[model samples]
Target: MTGLGEDVPQTAGAIWRRTVPVWAGLTALLVATLSLAYVPMGRFGIVVSLGIAAAKAGLVVVFFMQLRKPDPLLRLTAFASLIFVAFLLTIIFAEVLTRAPPTRPGTVMPRSAPDMPGLGQRAF
Candidate 1:
């Protein structure tokens, strides 16, 4: 009965633990996000929002979701999707910036309006 209680080890023996630096980095990022919430950045808001979202999403995918593990194809697929989305965004913005809208300056209608012959006024 002398050695009956010696089986338990110290708390450090659990082995499963997260690094302090990672938690610290995440906390800092979170604090930065909170601080940005109070600032009125206007047009810059979209850029800032996307940047922060990307950083936060990267953290979630890399650490929380452990996407860096075995299946490397997932990483490639994600990168490819980002590329395609960026390409699509570029095309949409280009079109929006280059296309001109129809207008009749001072008046409310176009100069060359189409003459529509209603069924009741048309002669065969």
Candidate 2:
């Protein structure tokens, strides 16, 4: 079978036109996401940060890669890539979620040290 009717009109221009807005939005999102890095979110921060990255990648795949108009095989290939990425993320996330937060070399200050019921109690 002569794939793509033997001469697909390389519509690269159309692809770019669809993606320019996506790229601009992505840039703005990246700046905003980076700003969040300075703000403290504790544990949830990592999840939110990565979620934004995934969304940007999704936009690139959809608009830049023209996934919406592709053949089923092409779509399947994209899906396979997503599945592979998800597998890697699962492993990395398992490691991250299980590992303990790093301990500082200096004294470990309690989160509520200033408000403790007995700041200097030897025993109950």
Candidate 3:
């Protein structure tokens, strides 16, 4: 009768059982990421790594942070933030691609001083 009115507490075993799948999933994802690091895809490797990282982040946010059970607005906000980040990245890449090639420093020095009609002889 002592616990009649109170909410039944979940047993530690039940909690572990429920969380075990999540733990396994995270571990598997970690292993996959590690394996992906060794595969050579040239430039596409960056895209693949970023995709895997995004998946891992999504799992953490959805399960560990319990975002899926919360109000819809929270999910919307998270998506909006991701969209903003993508926009920022697009702008950065655009600027990088359009920029002129870098020139070596100190490669070009003034060969001779500019001529000055009004000034007297220049000092070396």
Candidate 4:
């Protein structure tokens, strides 16, 4: 009678089989992200880049962290943490977008000051 807590011995081959595809996918995503940086897409560039990043992060969390296992508590905790992060990002974005633009200088300086009799001219 094996308990749920008992560790199952997995062969190296089994581990490799599961992880190889994930590694390849992550590598592909990395290449895509780097390539996207060079191609200018204006405002949509950030959206696409962030989407790829989120996908990469999801793969890492699910496979590397072994979050795919049937653990209700673990999944719930992960979900809660993601929600908190989303909330924080929303607040930060709101603050940044709502801020006023900086004020520009009223007047530009002249290359040389006008020669006033008492100002620049020194009486010897």
TM-score on alpha carbons, each prediction: 0.47, 0.56, 0.57, 0.66
Off by over 4 Å in 2: 1-16, 87-124
- The candidate that achieves the highest TM-score relative to the unseen native structure: 4
Over 4 Å off, model 1: 1-31, 40-50, 101-124
Ranking by lDDT: 4, 2, 3, 1
lDDT for position 100 in model 2: 62
lDDT, candidate 2, 1-124, per-residue tens: 4453337454889667766889898998899798998999999998999899889888888776777664788799999988998999999999999866658466455656555667576331
Clashes of each: 0, 0, 0, 0
- The model with the greater lDDT, 1 or 3, is 3
lDDT string for model 4 (46-122, tens) is: 99999999999999999987687777787899999999999999999999998665454654333344543465665
Q: What is the lDDT of residue 41 in candidate 2?
A: 90
After superposition on all C-alphas, the RMSD of every candidate to the true structure, in Å, is 12.1, 10.5, 10.4, 9.1
Report the candidate with higher lDDT, 2 versus 3.
Answer: 2
Top model number, lDDT: 4
Per-residue lDDT of 1-124 in model 1, one digit per residue for the tens? Answer: 3332345353653323443555677788888888998999999977887787788788877766656665567678878888999999999999998866546355344234356555686432
What is the Cα-based lDDT of residue 19 in candidate 1? 39
Q: Report how far off residue 61 is in candidate 4 (Å).
A: 2.0
Task: Give the Cα-based TM-score of candidate 3 against the true structure.
Answer: 0.57
